[model samples]
Target: MLYQEKHRPQLHFTPKENWINDPNGLVYYEGEYHLFYQRNPHSNDHADMHWGHATSTDLYHWEEHGIALAPDELGTIFSGSAVVDKNNTSGLFESASGGLVAIFTHDGESQQQSIAYSEDKGRTWIKYEGNPVIPNTKIKDFRDPKVSWHEDSKKWVMALACGDHIQFYNSPNLIDWTYLSSFGKEYPSHIGVWECPDLLYLPVEGSSKKEWVLIVSINADGPNGGSAVYYFTGSFDGKVFHPNEKPEDALKWADAGKDFYAAVSWDNTEDTYWIGWMSNWQYAGVMPVSPWRSAMSLARKISLYEKDGNLLLKQTPVIADNRKEAASYQDVTIQPDTAESYAISDTAQIDLRISEASSSTKWGVKFVTDQEEVFQLAIDTQENTYTFYRTEGMIDFSEEFPEEIKGTLNGLDVQNLTAIVDRSSVELFLNNGLTVSTNLIYPQGTVTQLEVFAVNDVLQIDNVSWTQLKSIWN
Candidate 1:
């Protein structure tokens, strides 16, 4: 298989090649952050899904490890969570073998939840001889177990993806689990089917409001395939999840992107950080001639804020911890009917803040080519919005192609727009990553020129920075 590496966001890890889906077993262990993903190691296709392991000291530079877990007689090593057993409460590890324990779904063709044990610092794992530690209970689609230590009750709590609901369970030693209750089903609009559920406590800033967020990914049939993260803000009462409202009243999407799915968080750290597979079920396994078919969004730092009587989750780029490489470009004043162009090197990240003087909205930045091809990010002053439009590149979709597909854009609010362009990908972070559009652009060569223009009226460009990124995978 061809392993073409690209310079991605700082501290956010991605695979060198092949398909990567679902952020599995994300946890901080032994002074390092370990992220395991669903990877098809032998090929770039989506078959033979196995768990590929990688660890990082600061969530930036990653060191690859041997395959963490593979499909045993089981169907596939599906999604799950991991935690550090500080007090050896799981009993899977001894005092001498003090490190971590991973609890994941062993989809044994029958598609049931099974447990495995790892004593050697999460390297090699042995299936719990008492396979299917949690009985299927005949739930049609029970998978993606997220386990956390419930300090309130002082016991282990886990959430499972049951069709249209999240089934709660409790375990004392991480081996035996008892069914608690189901969380969603009364409210039809809450979510159709809750896949990949994460329940955690996040400390609200400047307050003692330790809010519990129950995040679930929904797959609704349609163009979007209904992949989204809906969260309920409340307090967990150990034995049960008593939302302030009914289950239907607690659903809110974490992101408004077309590609975010199967997101899971690590419970080992204090920070509310999460990563999601950045592909959709509608387009999964359908990329053309791609050596790798999928990727995860840069790990996002999540926070809860009360807006308009509702708790809104704000997601920020977690790579800010390693942004020293970004440098400010020369400030350029924009004049009506005047456009400025800058020649870029191999790989670059450009950040710009647009301020409108009057009211005309047609301002934008264009990635220009000598052959007259252009990719544009345009602002609509009248609509108070911005859009990312692509007019070039070969995207061979099996179905009819649009002459131009507006990948993703957001309404202009307080936050500015940031664009990270590598050799093969263009990730546009709109409204400070509240919304994002990630697209693959297989440019034949280096993109050397970038132009900014005020399409209609005079616009003030506050700051622009272009930083050449160093490739770590090479």
Candidate 2:
């Protein structure tokens, strides 16, 4: 009865009650993937922050495990990272087998870094007596520490967001941290105070070498509007990060949509998987969802690839083995000014591939309800861009909700495309995940159909399939 609310997401993760934002302490340990988030247990609006916990063997179905970290004398638990301390590097475990160690921010008098250990697989936590391992040095916007084990120098690394730049530190035991270096003071794109900084090594698609990636989330100024993620690729010596490309050369955005923010990856996983709070700060508090005010974007498996001599990031959704196919089509052709329609459920995954397309082709897909409310995605071949429009539905709750979300195709040879559609969200992955867009919709009527229209040029589609996704919380 809890998740049966009108606009609850079936394919995404949402708290049963209260408000959640900025996923924290993401890690994979033993046989389960842990998702800890910033939660306000008392109300549907953000306040009284705590770290809420959940776990899943498969990324799709999750079991809530209640709160893991609460506000202590120092401060409220804020965004951070978790790791499996194998080899007992922190000397917290009695035996050689290390437990889970969380390095997070304590937002009290001034924001500072702290640590906690989970010996029972994150069920219970013990805050280190030595709180604020890395004390704040009077930085106004100091928070969100992302920590990981750096092997080359054989030291644990901490990437902390400090005002307009990211500060680096190293620790041998996750407790005593030493200052290493700082980056982003010369960075051209200082839109707002940086929050949620993550540093990791990502494997290049065609090469055996791995490159270091630093992700920074900024508030109030994004590619679209407010709260977006941007990343820089380069090399990280155990101490400092040197970008292969200058930060001022061109700013690379991780997600071009309005919703994706505070995206961080899970530690101790074979492949890097990421999740983000799927709401923009511009209109987050004013969203039309009840009971729970926020939901996360679908978990994206990320990797790096080279395109047109530029290294780019690709995000592919992890496919669940439990989805059931509802419909399939092959080699369907739509002439100019023609339209096709199909019945769909409230929660379904739509997979489509473009088999034949021309330079002048313009097409769009409309998710429609019987009440004539529509959310649309339009593709323009001439402009080499796609735009999302949600003007016809229940968008009056926030004036910022009706803005068009657009993304460039980068002259990509368009091929496979996918959309994960749920009761109140649509996540579109285009060109095999080269570009991803996420948006939240609150329609008065239930979405029951999908319509495709060719605005001008004829198009040939292939391997089209629709699969329904079961709700994790139902």
Highest-scoring model, lDDT: 2
Estimate, for each residue in 1-474, the C-alpha lDDT of model 2 and write its tens digit: 778888888788888888999999999998999999999999987788899999988887888888999998998998899999998999988879999999999999999999999899999999999898988899988889999999888999999999899999999999999999999999876768888999978888888977889999999778778888988989898998998777457668888888899999999998999999999999999898788889989899998888877778889987587565578988788777877899988799898888854332688788998788888999886788889997877888878888788888867756777998888888899887878888888888988898877887777887777888777765
Query: Any idea how many clashes model 1 has?
Result: 3
Task: Put down candidate 1 lDDT per residue, 59-93, tens digits, no spaces.
Answer: 65678787888887767888888877777776766
For model 2 the TM-score comes to 0.97
Cα-based TM-score, every candidate? 0.85, 0.97
* Model 2, C-alpha of 390: deviation from truth (Å): 1.8
**lDDT for residue 385 in candidate 2, whole number 0-100:** 87
